[model samples]
Target: MIIRVRDQFDAYSTNTNKVLEAGIDLKTRLFSEGGDSPYANIIAVNSKRVNDPAIVALVKALKTDKTKKFIKEKYKGAVIPAK
Candidate 1:
């Protein structure tokens, strides 16, 4: 029961099916077990203006200790927020 990346956020948190791991997560496991990674996993944003207070606030929030703890606790490492 593999789900696509586009549907994971909804399907993963709510759907009855148990999500074993994401493809990237599997690759991370393999990489740790001495196999090459299939590819890199990452997140990015392309905001037109980086100076907006909302945007600044978001970036700031994302880097904070509270936010990092919240993400780790809430997502349980399924969503790895970059440090």
Candidate 2:
């Protein structure tokens, strides 16, 4: 039997196949934006100044404690910065 729904609810609720992204609990994040996956959110810029000092500075800025905290708070464990 196949029942079409609006979004991933059918998959999340196990109303359909067991190939859903959810676990036993109703609140489980298997694969988030930046939890621990290789293929995840990517920040890329195609420009001649890609390797410029400004770009390096930008990356360094993202490693600050405040920035990390902000991401943690705002994203609520949904996004994890690279190591």
Candidate 3:
């Protein structure tokens, strides 16, 4: 069945044993198509809050290599870090 990359992870979790047996393929356009996927995890900051220390820190933390590594390890190919 057609599903987004992130949603496929959810399907994988629920159908870990059945996926291979059922012959279901979960492929993501992000990797296969070599083009940008419309889906993304965005962090929108308000104009006024852009300079807030907490917001700044949060954004910094999210963009760190450590965070990227965590996302890569935890989500496998399901989630991609923003560039």
Candidate 4:
């Protein structure tokens, strides 16, 4: 799965480690104004960005260890989907 970082700030943290530990190979990318892709399973936007409901949902989803582990196991060492 492709995990797109909403911005540079969101991408620059140990938060990705939590995803990595779960087994997914995270691909960080900046959220462009006209960019949208179905391949990105999660879009981790910084709280300071626009208060998008989707981003909020993604953040909530990543809050639990079980969710992280599930994501990790689901994508473990697998090539991220093309966007």
Candidate 5:
């Protein structure tokens, strides 16, 4: 009966194995990513740095399939990437 953000439960410090061993179910889908409680996680960039090569590269990397796959594999179903 722990209600919190899906991503929080997937963190390395969450001790998910212990929680599961304690009979806490993690597969229950209570709310979807965009059904009713629509939320977004944003990365804010400095206006002055928007055109910097590093920032451009980072943004480009984030929009790639590799990044999406990494997110899916690392976070499992906890984090959903918006298409």
Candidate 6:
């Protein structure tokens, strides 16, 4: 799966557009068949904050919950996707 975060911009509209662009770009790069597993699911997240530590923590928490739900619904045999 993928996670994307936005950066602050001069305007909220422009920032949102940039966030979408960045998310698409990241998804393409990370999921490209020549790059990584093409079957892997992609997840996009937007955040204006620019702190790596905070982002990491947030991602960890989100992954924990999301994984549980995903396993329960989608893949009952696996707790999480193999990275």
lDDT of 2 at 64: 86
Query: Clashes in model 4: which pairs?
Result: 22-72, 23-72
In model 3, the runs with Cα more than 4 Å from the true position are 1-35
Better of 2 and 5 by lDDT: 5
lDDT for predicted candidate 2 compared with the true structure? 0.53
lDDT for every model? 0.50, 0.53, 0.59, 0.49, 0.61, 0.44
Q: Compose the digit string of candidate 4's lDDT tens values, residues 7-55.
A: 3443433433455655444554233212243434456566687488777
lDDT of residue 39 for candidate 6: 50
- lDDT digits (tens) for residues 1-83 of candidate 6: 12232233332222223434454433332222322445545445566554567777866765686766775576333223434
* Cα error, candidate 2, residue 26 (Å): 10
Please provide, for model 3 over 11-65, each residue's C-alpha lDDT reduced to its tens digit, 9 standing for 90 to 100. 2342322443444454522232112766555789889999999999999999999
Q: Put down candidate 2 lDDT per residue, 1-83, tens digits, no spaces.
A: 22234254634322312323232332353533334566544457778878988887887888888888887786455456555
Residues 1-83, candidate 5, lDDT per residue (tens digit)?
34344356753334443444454465653434442335555668889988999988987898899998987787566656555
How many clashes in each structure?
A: 0, 0, 0, 2, 0, 0
The runs of at least 3 residues in candidate 4 whose Cα sits more than 4 Å from the true structure, single-residue gaps closed, are 1-49, 77-83
- Model 6 ranges off by over 4 Å: 1-36, 50-55, 62-74, 78-82
Cα TM-score of candidate 5: 0.54
Instruction: Output the lDDT of residue 3, model 6.
Output: 24
Stretches off by above 4 angstroms in model 1 are 1-48
TM per candidate comes to 0.45, 0.48, 0.54, 0.28, 0.54, 0.24
**Global local distance difference test of model 1:** 0.50
lDDT of 1 by residue, 1-83 (tens): 44565355532331211333333433223213112434334335566666777778887887899987887787565455455
Model 5, position 41: C-alpha lDDT score: 57
* Model 3 lDDT, residue 17, Cα: 24
Residue 54 of model 6 has an lDDT of 74
The deviation in Å at residue 38 for candidate 4 is 24
The lDDT of model 4 is 0.49
Q: Tell me each candidate's RMSD, in Å, in order.
A: 8.9, 8.3, 8.4, 14.6, 7.9, 13.0
Q: Which one wins by TM-score: 2 or 4?
A: 2
